[model samples]
Target: MVIQHGGRPEELRAAREECAEELGGEPTAPLADDAELSKFYDLQVEAYECLVANGYSPAPPSTREAFVASYYAGESWFAHQPAVPEGAPIPDTVCPQPMLADIEW
Candidate 1:
């Protein structure tokens, strides 16, 4: 599943567990040990650094409860939004190669 936005660890872990339950299996171990998983993990670290460099996450941390509440509330709000009309424009960012390359993997 695509995690389109960011939130606290507790919420993220809970959602992953729920997804695993729906899939009829246990939540898989994180790729800390697997070679391919490690690559992506390193990439995420690089991505986060890039975000910080680009002024995306210099904000102070919120409490866990507040963070989870915000995620749930945001999801609820989005669910009630009207669908986009055809031909609407979308914006995206390319991952910063310099950030990824600077990371020690």
Candidate 2:
């Protein structure tokens, strides 16, 4: 869960706690850079593909927001075990707020 700066810290913390309860684990702190973020997306995509290959036919929502909503509802690919483990520790060198121009995409 990438928490953008829309809410107060306490609100964000509460939301994170609620999400952890729903998802069955706490989310890692936001990824430090586009590289890490890309890696995260890649891992998720890989997991989704693996689940599909294994006959887990998750119906991903058409829109990103819908996907996220489904995820929070425990009705998305996130509900299944991934082929790879989630939440490997990120190094400190990756900045929390990386400049978009510096990222390779």
Candidate 3:
């Protein structure tokens, strides 16, 4: 199925979900541990810093503890939230969404 879809992300995700349903497993992978979460948070902070360096006025980030707590509570947390001014689009070239590759991990 992935090959049929040319390995597109949506296809890959759908495949995963289908497999999970059939195998009675989670449809999505969970974060490995707190270390991984910290790395993700660090990358987000770094991205916000990049935006600032490029003269974007992003709101300050919450403390790491708060971030972790929020994440565990299933609340969305993003550094770019409200940092972008209305009517001024932020380009992906400035700071694309952070993935595993975006962190030192």
Candidate 4:
């Protein structure tokens, strides 16, 4: 995705390092070692990118809980839903407001 605004490369890098540490890795080590951790890491990175792209600085410890909650909620909902038939037209739903709206950045 295009990063239209917020966060320099160095800042994103630092955030990744911090996330790695919190997940039981060295700051410079890879973020994932298995499929489950890979999924978690991917979501975490996406959350970080979305936060910064929306012009909010990373809030670390506070943001982490919300991100994890949202990710799992979405995942659970998706897991229970039936898959669309191939070639089915996708629905155009209204985009929701920012998930971080309540956060004091």
Compare the candidates by TM-score and give the number of the best one.
Answer: 3
- Model 3 lDDT on a 0 to 1 scale: 0.72
What CA root-mean-square deviation does each model show from the true structure? 14.9, 14.8, 5.5, 16.0
Ranking by lDDT: 3, 2, 1, 4
lDDT of 3 by residue, 3-100 (tens): 35558899888788887777798657756467777788888888888888887776678888777778867664666765544635556588876775
TM-score of candidate 2 to 2 decimals: 0.30
As a whole number from 0 to 100, the lDDT of residue 53 in candidate 4 is 57
Tens digits of lDDT, candidate 4, 55-105: 444433224344355554454211111233342322213212222222332
> Which numbered prediction scores highest in lDDT against the true structure?
3
- Ten residues in a row with the worst lDDT in model 3? 83-92
| TM values, all candidates | 0.28, 0.30, 0.60, 0.25
Q: Where does candidate 3 stray beyond 4 Å?
A: 1-27, 74-76, 84-89
Shift of residue 12 alpha carbon in model 3, Å = 16
Estimate the overall C-alpha local distance difference test score of candidate 4.
Answer: 0.41
Tell me which of candidates 3 and 4 scores higher on TM-score: 3
lDDT of each: 0.42, 0.46, 0.72, 0.41
